[model samples]
Target: KGISADVINIHTIKPLDAEAIIKSVKKTGCVVTAEEHNFLGGLGESVARTLAENNPAPQEFVATQDTFGESGTPEQLFEKYGLNSEAILKAAEKVIKRK
Candidate 1:
């Protein structure tokens, strides 16, 4: 496979890197956001908003669904919420299928 991936890190979400997001999504035709926060009103929302305004594409999110949290180690939380590398890979596979 000669596919190239376009990866961008938005460290500050107060002001999303919309230009970079649009540019990358335009090239890849899909997106997968992995965030360690609640899926609602998180980076996923910002990304959805950006795509809604600019270029929309099939997207998958690797984040915890909106719900109560329990005490656990970082690894446990990640494993429970499907935020690990396997989760990202699964999300990528899913989004690519939609494309």
Candidate 2:
């Protein structure tokens, strides 16, 4: 309950801030990337590739699975895709254990 975290938002994908990502992971020893899109080719993959090339560490992804979205309220969509705070907390816990 007393863990420290740093959040970084990558606005664009073509030129991902790998340096910043690596630096943060270097200090924290792990990472979790949450995005609205699928994890396959989304932020998770970018972070994973960056870490794999540079400072490798355990990472978790809180993104939508490989499935199509259905029409619903924003809250419902977020909850269904596991794109909420609870998912982030769970992912953080898992990644920390790996670290």
Best by TM-score: 2
Choose the strongest candidate by lDDT.
Answer: 2
TM-score per prediction, in order, is 0.91, 0.96
- Candidate 2: worst 10 consecutive residues by lDDT? 1-10
Which tens-of-lDDT digit does each residue in 2-21 have in candidate 1? 34567788898888999999
Clashing residue pairs, backbone N/CA/C < 3 A, model 2: none
> lDDT tens string, model 2, 7-97?
9989988799998999999999999999999989998999999999999999999999999879999899999999999999999999999
Lowest-lDDT window of 10 residues in candidate 1?
1-10
lDDT of each: 0.88, 0.93
The TM-score of predicted model 1 comes to 0.91
